[model samples]
Target: MHDGIVVYPTDTLYGLGGDALSDEAIMKVFEAKGREYHKPISIAVSDPDMIRAVACVDELAEEFIDQFLPGPVTVILPARTILSSWLTAGTKKIGIRYPNHEIALELISRFDSPITATSANLSGGPDPVSLDLCTVPYDCAINAGPLSGIPSTVVDLELREIIRAGAEIDAVAAFLAQWS
Candidate 1:
């Protein structure tokens, strides 16, 4: 599935995934969700090595990853040129997820690259915790029963702020508080 979209389960919610490096695949994801081009999409990586390949994980980001990753958190960091501008929405930063779900990890591992990690629903739709709520077009679906129903917390590591609070808000906030 080099340039195809897939609906797969994540630790938090089902994600509409596609090749992060493929403009065609990324566009398909956006079209499937009816998401605007200006909105940035996050990517899911199986491990730290994949994270480093796509993003510029600074010392602080590295520390943050060590502390809170392999879980439900989206860490925003400086983008490496290897990623398409379409994926990052022309922003020089990118949000990355290292999910704690086995199926999610296996999907990325088998694909051998990062995939778009946006929720599998319309742009303003409810969180898709189950396959019935996906409401999007995809080449394949990996129904892992149901997810946690909450979305991953989006933390901008560069600005040291939580853009969107979801899972582990208290712990994530406390960790960021240390920098303040």
Candidate 2:
């Protein structure tokens, strides 16, 4: 879905995705979810190269990515100048996800760019584990049945803290414990 938001399945939950670099696509995503501009949205990348392109990944962040990626984890790091402030909500940091699911990975790989990885639901609504659960409007959808019903465990590598606990939290905690 070029320049349009799509509903796609991830390892944890269904997501509303659009081109992360396109302000038009990003705004459509925001409108679909009714999410505030101040609240930043996470992005999904296909691999480490994409991650490096979007964020300023340091040694610690690299270790964290190596330890737990292609799974249910979102790593927050310093944003590169390429990303728009709207995408980062005027913050210097951005959250990234490299999902383990095949459909999600393939989508990003084919798109050749990062896409918004926010849950496909109204802001503050329940997790979207299945197509029916998603309330946000999208141009198209890739149905992969139900997901894990859990969101990714968001970790801020710069702050070295878990922003929000979700899937695979124990492993994330152990990783943080070793570093912290």
Candidate 3:
């Protein structure tokens, strides 16, 4: 699915991804999910260097990432110039995920580029835990049975705040608290 959207598995739930830097691909992801342009999408990075390529990571952010990456945390960081405004959803900050699942990791690593990490479901719909539960139109689908059915906990390091509470909130909170 070159320059197109693909439905794949994540640690928490099924997700849809495309080229993070391609506005066209980003549009397809938004269109497929019925997501509004104003709603920002997170990106999945194959490795730590990929994260550095897209975002400005500070000591706190790096520490947090090191502590719980490749797990279930979405760390929001200051956007770098390389990412398109569409990927950032007109914001200066972007959410990032380093999935723990091997299938998801392999997909991103093999893709050799960052891909969109938005949940694969209609906008405002329940997040899908299984591939069949995802109704969004994607060029390819990778089923890995069911997921944890929980969403990733989102942390905005710049604000030193927890944006969304999810499966790993407690652990993230405890880790971030040490920095304060």
Candidate 4:
């Protein structure tokens, strides 16, 4: 398994990453970004079963996963057995993303477990969208050139609400509306 926090391109921006299961690795991401523990860190899972293993899955979640995942969207759901408080702060919910980029998938595949997917910047700084403007502010950067420059849409499954609208809102909205 890969050790230490890594930097990489993501759909939203460059991401600072680490093993989702390792408390030390997780701490590195927070430290590298000067991020707070109060805000939950998002995790990236390449396999559907892996995601199902960590986050409580419902029919709606499955539907959304089948449709918008491997794209620009993060689905926030109730945390499951494998997810630790390190990833979710003290909350019982976790945010997950299955990015569309091949490089992202390859990195996740290599890590075996889910990896943290926080924007590759300090907590209150501007996110780097292109490699020219990107800086490796973490332990390592799993380079994949510039990213798509669009942040993922964030959907809250517990509240059944769209927290942030991005490029995939229309598609995401239709998928959620079906449940309501």
lDDT of 3 by residue, 1-180 (tens): 558888899999998989998888998999998888898999999889999999999898788878899789899999999998988878899999999989889998898889999999999888899988898998989989989999999999998889999978989889878877
Tell me the tens digit of each residue's lDDT in model 4 across 34-84.
888898999998878888989999887888788888889999999986777
lDDT of each: 0.94, 0.94, 0.91, 0.82
- lDDT computed for candidate 2: 0.94
Candidate 2: where is the Cα deviation over 4 Å?
none
lDDT, residue 25, candidate 3: 92
Candidate 2 residues 65-172, lDDT tens each? 898889999999999999989889988899999999999999999999999999999999988999999999899999999889888999998888999999999999
Error of 4 at 74 (Å): 0.2
Candidates ranked by lDDT: 1, 2, 3, 4
lDDT of 1 at 103: 96
For all candidates, what are the clash counts?
0, 0, 0, 1
lDDT of 2 at 1: 75
Stretches off by above 4 angstroms in model 4 are: 1-3
Worst 10 residues of 4 by lDDT: 131-140
TM-score of each: 0.98, 0.98, 0.97, 0.93
Pairs in steric clash, model 2 = none
User: Which is superior by lDDT, 1 or 3?
Assistant: 1
Candidate 1: where are CA atoms >4 Å away?
Answer: none
